[model samples]
Target: MKLLNLQRRMARAVMTPLTHSERMRTVAPDGRSMRAVASQIIKPNDRLTSFERLEIYNRQYWFRVLSAFAEDFPGVRAVLGGRRFDAMAKAYLIDCPSQSFTLRNLGSRLVSWLQKHPSRAGERQNLAVDMARLEWADIEAFDGLREPSLKPEDLAGVNPAKLRLRSQPYISLLALRYPVDDLLLEVRKDSDDLDVASNAFNERHKRKRVGAVAKLNPSAIFLAVHRLDEDVYFRRLDREEFAILSALQAGKPLSAAIESALRGSLIAVADRAAHVEKWFHTWAALGWFCRLEKSPKNEKAASRQ
Candidate 1:
């Protein structure tokens, strides 16, 4: 085989999913004996056969990928029991394998995959989806881009009718059907002690903790996943607050964003002005707003290394 063809064949063999016992299958999907295929590409060492040598690479590839997926979505695993999470993760990865050079994007398609394959999530499908969304948002916020924030002086005298602002690139707005934020934080706090396959920290324990099951009852939850310094945080938002921020992030002017926030608001028109002022003050303090225009004179953006 030419060098490129040989490299492709090796990658295909390594990426082939392992069996339930985490062993390389004896036969490839094309019905070729794995031993024969291995012999063609690998030379046997003193203590190992060609098949055994190839099996090592195959197992390691899957082990790392599975570990990466688990690390990114521990909250989802908590929602779905460990075993089911493993099975669903394997199936999802087989269908949507990592396409990026880094493992950071491995679970990027997971929420959609769960949506399509609801059976994979069992009884708590919505909860699982929400947990996945929140977990993924955490990932996005941690490594997301940062630009110079609009400071108090920068916004001074700016008119809301014409003010054009953008949300910090790292601020992720999420609308969810469950109170998954609590569950996610709880899961992550104790994740280090939980064994993935043995259900060492089983779902039953979750139900007992302050009625975790009841806490997960369907509710409209809006959140902003944002970073301060080096750590990420989940901030609960009022429905109107979520709407206003999302509208602003969509490139709407301050006046129009406020209008969008008012469309379905339950807060009275008289009460809204105070709430709006408070929201803008809080968001501004958090460095959530960025100037839409850029110039060399603009303060240089700081990025996490």
Candidate 2:
């Protein structure tokens, strides 16, 4: 076989899903016999046959990917429990195989996947999905790009009608049904304080943890998951605050963002302006807003001075 064809064939055999025990499947996903496929692609060594040699790659690939996936979504795993979460992770990987060079993008489709396949989450589908979103946002905030935030003086004498502002690239605006923030916080704290590995899978321990977490009823709230210095923090947002920040992030000018923020707002007309002003002051202090960058043409013109 040509080199490209040989590589393609090897990849097919390697990416094939594993059996429940983490061993290579006898049958390939395409219905071909893995033994026959392995014999054709690999050579027998002194001790290991072609099938065994190929099995090593198959087992290692799945193990590495599964470990990476588990690390990325420990919160999701806690919600679904280990065995169920393992099965769901396997199924999800089969549906959406790793498409990126790095494993960091492994759970990129996880939230939507959980949304579509609620059965995988058992009784805590919505809660599991929310936890997934929060965990993913945590990853994003950790390394996301940040522009130089504006100083309080930067907004002085500015025209709100035409001044364009941008939210930090790391800010993740979330509208969720459950108070998953607290749950995730507890999960993180426990992971630090206790090994909890045995407790995570122990039915009694899982039940106690799950029951405590599950008692929180569905209440809609807005949140911003953002990074400060090197640590990530979750801050709750008022409905109007969320609306205005969302609009600003979508590239609206400040005036338009404030206007849209007021459309369905219940804040009294007299107090609306004060709220927006106060919100802006607080937001600017947090270094969430950055001035829009100048275009290359404008930069060149300004540099000529």
Candidate 3:
């Protein structure tokens, strides 16, 4: 084989997902022999055979990839416990190997993957999905791109009827079936406390404390995850507020977004009008909207005026 082709084959061999024992099997179910493959490509070191050398890279590759994935989804790990989380992480890696240049993208498909394989998630499937969503939102909120925020003066002459709002690219809207934000916060708190106490204490006591954190409770939740002052925050929103913001994020004009918000049964007709201005002011101060863009129809109407 050509050197470049040989290199490619060796890379695939090391990256092929398999246990150490499976790696030694001859003509295994997958129709590839690690021993035969290694002999063809790798030369033995003084003490290590070609297969032994290849095995080192294989184990290390999986360990590093799995570690990065676990770091990104710490809340999921906490929810699923160590053993199950490890198994699921291994399976997930095999199914959705690292295709992106950046490890941050590793969890991009995790939420959908979990949904498709709910049986692997055991009884807390929905909760696992929620946690994954929340964590991914946080990741995006922290590193996602953003346009310049609209300042208060930028709205000076804007007409509410025709004002189309653009959401900050960093803003993420999520409607979850569980209070995963609260659960994540509690889990993080326990983790922080454990780290602090670990230095002065024993392992058994630390494990007990970690086990004592509050259990997750299911609740309908609407959340806006966004960045403010270089920090990511999770804000709980009313259903009506979420509806309005989501519509605005979807590129609806202010008038239409209000209409969408009012469509929710939770907000009374009388209360809707009163809340519109208040919500707008709160959103503006929070830097949720990037800038107001005049719709073409509105521009034409104003031109005729």
Which candidate has the top score in lDDT?
2
In candidate 3, what are the lDDT values of residues 205-299, reduced to their tens digit? 43343344324455678999999998999999888889889988887778888886787466677877778879878888887877544658556
Off by over 4 Å in 1: 192-204, 207-211, 214-216, 294-305
If ranked by lDDT, best first, what sequence of candidates would result?
2, 1, 3
- Writing each residue's lDDT as its tens digit, candidate 1 over 1-305 gives 79999898888889888988999999877787888889999999999999999999999999999999999988888778779999999999889999999999999999999999999997878888988999999999999998888887775555666666788988899999888888777766565446553344445665454246545567788999999996999999999999989888886877889998898789998999999999989998898988547432222221111
TM values, all candidates:
0.89, 0.90, 0.87
The full ranking of all candidates by TM-score, starting with the best, is 2, 1, 3
lDDT of every model, 2 decimals: 0.84, 0.85, 0.79
Which consecutive 10 residues in model 2 have the weakest lDDT in total?
Answer: 296-305
Inter-residue clash pairs, candidate 2: none
Question: Of 2 and 3, which scores higher on TM-score?
Answer: 2
Residue 192, candidate 3: Cα error in Å is 1.6
Output the worst ten-in-a-row residue range by lDDT, candidate 1: 296-305
Question: Which candidate would rank higher by lDDT, 1 or 2?
Answer: 2
- Model 2 agreement with the true structure over 114-153: per-residue lDDT tens digits: 9899999989998899899999999999889888998866
Highest TM-score against the true fold, candidate: 2
lDDT of model 2 at position 95: 88
Candidate 3, residue 186: the lDDT equals 65
